[model samples]
Target: MDAGLTPVRVVGAGPVGAVCALALAQQGVPVCVLEAQPETARGDSRTLALAQGSRLILERLGVWSRLADVTPITRIHISQRGALGVTRLDAGDLNVPALGYVLSYAELAAALKQALRDADVAVEYGIAVARIGASAAAAELATADGRTLATPLAVVADGGRGDDAPQPRFERDYDQMAVVCDVQTELPHAGQAFERFTPDGPAALLPKGDRYALVWTAARADAERIAALPDTAFLTALQAHFGGRRGRFLEAGPRKTFPLKLTWTGSEAGNRVVRIGNAAQTLHPVAGQGFNIGLRDAWELAALAGDTPADALGGAAMLAAYARGRRADVVGGLGFTDFLVRTFSNDLGPLRHARGLGLLALEAFPPAKRFVARRMMFGANG
Candidate 1:
């Protein structure tokens, strides 16, 4: 396979795109990666919660050992504010070393980039895809600099930000904002993550190094107010809301806020262009499903492409199979996260009582709990 005439072209050099390209290249498939941003500007400060399955994928890609500042989550605690509902998920139940991991987005990106370089994959940074379309023979792409290229398959993993990317077939605006920061609790995290559902939204505290990565969800107005508070005031507010589960929050890092939404580009893989990762679906961050599902999308696509002959890389049959294969996992993840956001983020009396009972039941049933845990750690197929 010629490097210049790669059969597959992947857009976006983010975690998903990098993983897809690296996985394919490692499997003896020639792949070229186009990144809209320059290498120096690709650092992302956001924290990512990667499932155990995702760790396996990275380990297969040979970048897992290169990641720095990673914190493993051995258990997860689920509860509802002002309710009797409480459930805990432990990695020991499944005999896994950890349920998930927390690391900076930039660290993962760095590791993947290093692996790609070592694999001799061609990655052209700052080469934006201005337009992309597919034909029976190949997928055509128009670059921002007026250069045109074609490949047997074009994978759009740029989080649906490309110009020619299809409009989201399903769109939602949750009218909530997630205020994200790192906070230090008086007591150690002990490798436990917490998800506390409140009337505003769901707040997550994932153990990250010496501090906990905090995702405080709230209504738009409330989130704005919280984001603008001084460090001391913010810590006080977080302490009041998150309760004493982790003891008092002593120190805080800079905070940022992002609006919540669910966006999906449908499951129809049109022509030779297949959208995966965030380009395929973007879910609410309730259960940390979005990024991990994107990783699975990348890995599965790479595996399917590797098995298929080069001449039939982006054929209708192959694309269709990819879509069908991913439908269950993608839809299940979307539904699970959306359900949590809708069902638990409110304080309605009837639903609150029902949710409490449901949590109690889930805790009491080992098999059912294990099923859900595996689903989160892997996917619907797991």
Candidate 2:
């Protein structure tokens, strides 16, 4: 509430929200972040595959160095189930330090929050949003505690929900659950990340130091069964499904499961509000693009706002520009991930043969491998 300070309001304190705040605050803009959670938690078991572009954003925010000790993804391996060929990509191929880094979600969030604190961004914690309304001049946000705050622009980083918001949307439920957990392996992962497409779903193993973080997508019933298995039993099941790609699965840490879905929000320009991050789109995690895409949205919006006048930050003109800039990337990413999930998550004979052949072709062609590598390291949108 300082005089002469340009005001921007952001909801949610997860990665996207935190990164947006950091980006804006770094550019000398005053930002207020409303987070429902009181205190940022640590040791969030969810692991994230940070693309090279995402790393650059974090580095700009002064967060990558603090996360270096916990983030490591030196290589990536992709293959189709029951297929004879596999493609491998190393950071050396791209001549980059590393293709990407895998870090704990909670750790990254905490790091960003700390950076925000150091940058003096005001964060109102433990307050839930009660209602939101926007006008041409400013956005009014009412918290559950009955406090109303107004700002020139309001960015909703909250996860997907279809309500009275002005943004039009498209959504699809995959009827799948991603069962995630950290596991201890007998062999070192050697900083290699695995994306294995099986009949049930796409399972990813991301390197986390001496162990691996597992994201297994499967039917709800199967996910429930897998979640119920004992540590040793789960390891056996995992070994049977994953094979020796990384190494023998020794033991698993805590396990959790959540439904997977694909969502997209239409342009929010005509209306006086803008939705960024997961609120704008929630992608299937099969490609590890969910958080990466969200971060890109946040960074791009922040950059646009920083380059524009205060009065232009969240206005129709600015929001329209943002929507136009983000549309292609968002649609393409959603389509690609959804296609892979549907193509690989079944045993249909024709589609199976086609997808397997596609994988083989990519393995045989160096350029194809490079294209996939580039897309994974730097999103097609980036």
* Most accurate candidate by TM-score: 1
Best by lDDT: 1
Judge candidate 1 against the unseen true structure and give its global Cα lDDT, from 0 to 1: 0.90
CA lDDT for candidate 2: 0.82
lDDT, model 1, position 195: 94
Q: Per-residue lDDT tens digits of candidate 2, residues 314-366?
A: 78888889899887777878887898898889988788778877877887888
Collision pairs in model 2: none
- Positional deviation of residue 378's Cα in model 1 after best superposition, in angstroms: 0.6
Residues 1-382 of candidate 1: C-alpha lDDT, one tens digit per residue? 4745556999998999999999898778889999999877757679999999999999998899998789999999999999997999999888999999999998888888889889888889988999987778888889999988989998888888876667788888899999999999999999999999998999999999999999999998899899889999999999899999988999999999988899889545648988888888988888999999999999999999999988888889899999999999998998898888999988899999999999999999989899989999999988
Quantify all predictions' global Cα lDDT against the true fold: 0.90, 0.82
TM-score of 2: 0.95
